[model samples]
Target: MRPKIYLFGDSITEESFGDGGWGSSLAHHFARTVDVVLRGYSGYNTRWAVKVAERVFGAAEGGGGGVNNEEPLVVTVFFGANDACLPNRCSAFQHVPLDEYKRNLRSIVSFLKKRWPTTRILLITPPPIDEDGRLRHPYIENPSNEPERTNEAAGAYAKACVKLAGECGIPVIDLWTKMQQFPDWKNACLRDGLHLTRSGNEIVFEEVVKKLAEEGFSPETLPVDLPLITEIDPRDPLKSFQQ
Candidate 1:
């Protein structure tokens, strides 16, 4: 069976399959070598993610459709944008206390470790927000057009995420910090303050590939799904196929 790479998180993740998305880039990079499974739940925070962790990743028993027989080679956890929403903001429903957020993140990592014991886990910090851009979003409901999230708030969660990754002995992609270093990052990296743009996704994909190389999963080490065409017999095509 083909190995798998699992991506778990919230809206940022759910949209990772979109045009010029990071998930799509990874899928293309590993095409035929591994299956990329996206388990993104838009608008979900770590608190909600923890509740359904087992259901999504638990090992199967008795031939159920669960992944009992196969474990993902890599799993990435990316969340926190919604959780960083200000308690009194328009997006209060998604607010999660800093302490609770840390606990939930730990729980998520623990669950993945238990279910896929040999899988390498990567934790990604939520990207920084652009308050002015967010306020300009047509869908925002605040009368004062106040942004629901702030880069400072998201940075705090990002810090917590990095700390948790260290405690768990996993690698983390500090997107919040790294993206801001780019020139004109506010407009180049994020589209609506919270979600990533094409350039941002490219950065994410690049970082992920770098991490995979560091973890020894470089393309040179992975197996291709099919044999080379040169290996097929020209004299007997049917026989070569059967072989």
Candidate 2:
């Protein structure tokens, strides 16, 4: 079986398989070498992720929680955008307190480590939010005209995520900080001020691949699953296909 990478998170991750999406880019980059799996849930937060852990990762039976018996090459934990929603805003239903958010993130990392001891776990911080963009592309009705989320709130969540990753000794993609490095990140990197745009997807794809490469999963490092035509002697092609 091919090695696999799993993605877990909220809307941003759920839509990662779309056209020009980072997930799709990864799939293409690793085609014929590894399988990329998606396990994203729209509108979810760390708190809810912990709640559904048993379901996503089957009950702790026979040692490995049952997403699969094979240990994945990497697994990404990305949740926070929604967790940063203001408690009194339209997205209040999904609001989770800052303290609880930190606890939930730790719970998730612990859960993954238990499930795949040898797998590389990567954490991704939530990207910065554009208040005007959110208002323009509202996910929910905002009659009060107040943004359900704010850049400040999202920054707090991102900081917590980065700190958690450091404490846990895992690599992290600090999208919040990285995106802001671009002058027009609000429009260039994010489509709805929260989700990624094509350029944003490009950034994610590059970062993920770069990180995975450092962890020894580069294209040159991975063995190809099947022989390319050039690898076969035209006169004895069958020999190259021997399993």
Candidate 3:
């Protein structure tokens, strides 16, 4: 079977298979070499994610609680957009306290490591927020109409994520800091305020590919599951299977 890569996070990851999305880009880039699995929960926070992780990661093949025998090549922990929402705002229902958010991330990393010690795990921080853009595209009705999420708040979460990765000795994609480095990033990277645009997805795809390469999962490094059509001889197609 081909190796797998699991994506775990919220709405941004849930929509990552849409046109020009990073997940799709990675699937295309890897082709026959690996499988990219999406396990996204729209509007989910780290607090909620930890509760359902085992069920999500456990394999359904042998039985309800059976574990997938083959370890995934990598698993991405991408979250915090919703967790960073202001506690007193319209989206307050989704807000997770900062300290708790950090603990949840640590718990998640611990779970993945205990379950699959050899698997490479990476963390992706929440992206920068565009306050005015969020106001323009409000997700829910608000009595005060204030933007529920701010870039400053997201940055705090992002920094925590980065620090966690450093402590764990794992790779991390600091989307919050990286996106801002680009000029007009608010317009270029985000669609509404938190969700990603095509360009934003590109940054993710490129960064992930770099991480995968560093961990020895690139196209040239990983073995393709099947031989190319050209590799099969018309007269003796069976020869391809022998290899």
Q: What is candidate 1's CA lDDT for residue 186? A: 94
lDDT of each: 0.89, 0.90, 0.91
Steric clash pairs (candidate 2): none
lDDT string, candidate 2, 43-136, tens digits: 9999999999767766666443447557789998889999999999899999999989999999998988997799999999999999999999
Estimate the lDDT of model 1. Answer: 0.89
Identify the runs in model 2 with alpha carbons over 4 angstroms from their true place.
62-66
Q: On a 0 to 1 TM-score scale, where does candidate 3 land against the true structure? A: 0.95
The sequence of per-residue lDDT tens digits that candidate 1 reaches over residues 5-44 is 9999999999999999999999999887889999899999
- Lowest lDDT sum, 10 consecutive residues, model 2, at 60-69
Task: Give the clash count for model 3.
Answer: 0
Evaluate residue 91 in candidate 1 and report its C-alpha lDDT on the 0 to 100 scale: 86
Candidate 3, residue 51: Cα displacement in angstroms equals: 0.6
Rank all candidate structures by their lDDT, best first, as comma-separated numbers: 3, 2, 1
lDDT against true structure, model 2? 0.90
lDDT: worst 10-residue window of model 3: 59-68
